[model samples]
Target: MVSKPALRTGGYIFKFFFRETKMNISISKKGISALLASVLLTLAAPVTTLANVKNPGLLVHAADDEATTLDPAQVEPGEGGETIILQVYDRLLDIDPYSPNLVPSLATEVPTIANGGISSNGLTYTFKLRQGVSFHDGTAFTADDVKFSWDRAMEMDLPEGNAGALSDVVASTEVVDDFTFKVTLSEPVADFLNSVVVAMVSSVVSQDAVEANGGVEAGSPNEFMAGNMVGTGPYKFLVWNRNENIQLEVNDNYWGENAKLNVRVEIGGDPDVRVLGLRAGEFDTVETDPSFVADLEGADGVTIYTGGLLLEPLHIGFNLNIPEGSLPDGDTIPEDFFHDPRIRQAFNHAFDYEAFLNGPLAGYGAFNPHYTPIGIFGHDESAPVYAKQNYAEAERLFKEAGVWDEGFSVSVITEEGNLFALMCLVLKDSIEKLNPKFRINVLAVAEAVFDDAHAQNPLEYAMWAKNADPAADPNFYMQAYQHPDGEWGEVHGFANGYKDAGKVAELIDAAAVELDTGKRAALYKELNEILYNDPMWLIGAQEGVVMAHRDWLKGFVQNPLWPRPSLKFALFDK
Candidate 1:
């Protein structure tokens, strides 16, 4: 799927126009009718498409699901499924674009432990909440909201899927005053500042609102979250059609310079519906498939922004379990998991990494990435790199590892219809090529996949998200890929950490304690190298957020928080 660069701008910037789609398509019986109809239309009309509006404000699209609410306390960490989380909700701290460094979200500075270092005895930590911020409701924000949100998100029983990340961090909370509160950490922590980077709790959700909506429950998402967002952000919520579409109007009451979009956002739905609409020029901004980037060329006034997935790197996971370990409840890992490490190794080598990147994922910043959070400090280029289509070498590895038995059966799990599932299909093709006898089963639903993936013991699950605050610290992320007693996620035991958890723990701890950049960098270097050789996760192309907009759009660009539009900046061109 690799293509020679059609245009180059200096050595640093290579402009690749479009990557062609390469999915194997054997004409289907059902598609034949549509294919013939298209062919007949092509012959009948010298298609003359007309010009129209390129972008429009307060865009509406049709999507499948609607968020439950706009309450930050509810969808705070934000769902990967919700592309607009950032547009509606923002943190007090922010990610510096160029350096991607962590800094104040709600607070002006990182809270210092010395002001009261969380007592080494693992008892308590205290902080002063930043003042002057107001909630969307116009109520004055206070310390109680902080205590309430923290207690609600961490200690309480929140939604199972959305609230998994904050499990166990809070022990109790106390509001010292209108602007001061104390949080008791279950354990003394070095990266307590990392906690704030999580979409700030009180910064977006008020204490009273929580009680009215669902209180400490932080109940499932509702219209408040889906269509209406109320945070201390530069823009206020205008409307959201759940998954189908959404729009964000400016908040003149914002604390900073307001976002420029007359309204920012429109997303989700049929590609052809958007395509024909865009070609007619009825819309201003919308996504055009990278493969169709060629068609977009020469269309007057159309500009296809160029970028790639430089951060939020993607990866497929292997979930092989060993028999010796006990589940958290003391049940033993199933024996089938250890049937052979070579089988696990085969899947790793079989990935068709380059094909998808240069094809469907082209132009989205889908590049081969090393195992650090994209754009983070301490990324080591020398780490064992996984790149391109390596069918031959993957086969060699399979043979060398003895995975070529006559009948090898394994199930690959991924959420159906997602890019991750598509990646699994690519790997399946490559693996089958290596060992003609190998059999792969692809499962698309998350619930079904989770059932098998999170069972008492697992054989394997392809790249499902390993959720945690990677921006805050890699320690928790590193801790995630290990054999576990069912503590974190069911797949924990199969991740890279289980093989040598003790060593991984030691190195990660050492890296955390070293404050000096030079020392921290050195330790991190060692960590990436260790992780590379040990290979916890099968890293994939770091892909950027894929979004669609009408051609009239000018200012809309990918936001770091594009995971959801809640944080997106959009204002009309003057």
Candidate 2:
């Protein structure tokens, strides 16, 4: 039984296994001495630069997530501030770093109704700017800086801002001269130009560097544009240091292509210190983990792109209220413990989904349904997917929901060391190997303590895992993960966990104002067959979009609709 050689790299094949350790990274209550003291403080830090930054015009990367805010109307949505607002901001339509199509940076064309710049009752859009550009503090990029950067993100509606992708359906932002701009829209969205003007919170910035630094108020959070950045793109802002790194530099009044290289990013959250600083060339690029692709396979010059399927669907959720005495130390569960739809279809037929797509997605991924995320537009490759690991139909639906021999202990949470703590240790080893008095536990923590216990409202954990925020359509993933009042259904209560939750919020509010794109893909393929028979999230596995870098690091563009650490350093160079 000897067959394992597969490598490839630039054309993507990868099958390596020359292991002394190919993932035994057990994240059980964070041991391994805090991951070997974060890999010896990422091998004794100090690779920093910017007091005369150097080396063939700099290019670092190394990220695992930093950038809390360089404030492109307060970033947040897979925040590393969207790889620093896709390199110092400028989005009035952009996507297509490698293809979800819409291009026209700082708006020059893509509006449609066959380019009448939209307004055939699609509630007006009109852009046309991008003339002599200019805003890395040089000011002049107008239409009043796209109506003061979307009216200062809908008047700073910063509740952890992403300003509901422009306070959900704009409704006014005109300037119409000095290179014209318009907007209108109190409705008629139809994927508003691939989801909110190619969103990085619809960038644009610099209405004279935010009214000379500190202007737009209403809900607050400008604090000098949350750590300064002035915009117009092609790399500009150059200093962040918090948690160590984020610098950029090549914009020299950039209006078009000037950004040969000069970026840093580097806030390395140890994936073995970003593969030991990308095999010690001191990181040309890093943050690539499919359980650390055998520590960057044949590491000589490292390539590993492995791109493709990413509408980002990693699910697990389930919460349904859990607050009372917020379960933790020996989780006893039951604050309506996932409000039974046969105990949420017996934890979605006891999820093993091919051992989580060959363990923590090392076999890359697939399989998505609730809120339909495969490649967007109503993804129904014949819907129904439990990825077949039945275990006697999850022990006859946990003994017909009588909680199978009265057993149930909980705790799921995640985030500690990526892949949502290895898919919560594959759902605590597939439901405690199907009931040895079924207990499960995992917890993990640390992405800012699991985003402050996943923003509490009721999610004090009965289950929690992540992924899903990368969309070109699928009505903003059925209004923030299957609307029951949307946004994790008003923080996990899904109006007391769905069985009909008002007809899945009336077919996600009639597929978000459907302008008949085949009746909004038949009301999102009938809410993916009514949430695949009433399952309120367990959707797991939909990954694939790797990266790795440094075969002389030229023009990196792995797309997946570009956002989360999806590198776009002004189309790299070195």
Candidate 3:
């Protein structure tokens, strides 16, 4: 259903508001949200006419599919990182969500080797840029478009490529003049400015929209950037249809301030058709699910908010090598009888996870033991708890780790929630009460077979599931879940393979080049004691930053990263 013409989207249909108004600073996604109450009554004017006007507010975000492209180097972050980082590309460095540090857009600051910032031999880094920052196809934003968007996803290799994160301490980028540039590093890379504000390595691209859209390739520029978008930030890209809706307007020559609001986006295939188009008003703000959080908990024109959700680690990934690890082309992994760590410590003490977080989240939810999620660094809200019925210490840790081969059993893939189908029926009734020769097999697959069995890394399931949130960086758990051939936390880090000694990938490179906040929190508390004693992964709860608006959707903030339902200091209460 590629759809999108069923206009009057929320119904009672006001028959066209008379189209044609998307020019001098485009408007009308709902007619610039009814001019957002006269730009919040001219918000005390004069920052150059609020930097050219276009804020007031109306944000809508909800994804079930269809944002696979919006040009952050031809988007495909597997699927929606909040519709390509808050309404398509802007990074000249971001991430300040109240103190994770590094701000400034299209750069004026943020780029220095502690001042002199050298590498004449320390490997190199120069930078200067940020002059008259242009490019919504107006060209001019140089240092050779930040050395062609930092080596354009490895000269067009992109699959959201960070050019293999600039292979072994970069070795190129020399512009050094028109606003300077250098970068050379083959060594000293400790947070080389958070590995160069990655949006596909320092996103700035526009070598004439990369040769009008295909000379600096990597795939998915959404057929030449959907509606011709180019960015210096503060909104500009106005239309997309590929799965059902996307709109961003308000670049009013933006250098800053003029960001009141006018960013609409959707991927709605169905979540009851996005809460019936946000309860029939169409949508002014969105981020629904968790079984529509008990149908909007309080209702009456919705508002619901919830924490900031530290980035995403909703968790479950197993492929240590087949019966959980040691794959050979995948699926049907139940052998050597799960090579016994007493059957992965009897399915990790047969997950009761506090009676599945006190049955259906009435208790709301809690239990994460760090595979890294709750605001990063091995979060361990006191680790040990998973006994809905600990089958006598999971049959004494499955006959003391002999992997109780009572005809061997292991198969747990899930995805339809009562919090993961009640932990896949509490690991199939506590791993069949730890013996009946222990047999457990629960399947569930829906939502494109849970996204095509985790993008086809399936080996007949011994373990598989989804959840995420840790990419604000600390090599986001070694470049997405222990870089096991990582391409950005592919449904639970490292679909297992890419140098597996995973000693938290060398303490995620000493907490990503050690900027030293108590030695990067003591090298992330020694990589959370080798990620909770190498459980490889299993963080279950601690994600609350939810949102559901309508009480006139007042001044929003939300962003814990990704289009977390963009509000960026949102407003519209009048």
- Among all candidates shown, the one with the greatest lDDT: 2
Q: What total of clashing residue pairs does each candidate reach?
A: 69, 0, 26
Tens digit per residue, CA lDDT, model 3, 324-363: 4543333334444433444454566665555444433333
| Tens digits of lDDT, candidate 1, 456-567 | 3343343343222334454445445421333333444533334565665676666655545687677777767665545546665666554444445545555453343222
For residue 378, model 1's alpha carbon misses the true position, in angstroms, by 3.6
Better of 1 and 2 by lDDT: 2
Better of 2 and 3 by lDDT: 2
- Rate residue 258 of model 2 by lDDT: 84
- Residue 464 in candidate 2 has what lDDT? 86
Give lDDT tens digits, candidate 2, residues 1-574. 1123444332233343222223322232254445455445544655533341224678988777566787877777777778787788888788777666778888778878786988778889898888888888776787887787878887888887788787778878888788988888888878888888888778888887778777888888888888988888988887887776878898878877788988877774656656756655566887775766766766665678887777778888887867688788887666886787777887888878776776556778778778777766677788777775677877897898777887878888876756767677767777888888889888776676887888788677788888877877888888887788988888887778687799888878777777778888877878888887778788768887777876677777767777766668778877
Score candidate 3 by TM-score against the native.
0.33
What ordering of candidates by lDDT runs from best to worst?
A: 2, 3, 1
Clashes of 1: 69
Q: What is the C-alpha RMSD of each candidate to the true structure, in Å?
A: 8.3, 18.5, 19.8
Candidate 1, residue 140: lDDT: 72
All candidates: TM-score: 0.71, 0.37, 0.33
TM-score of 2: 0.37
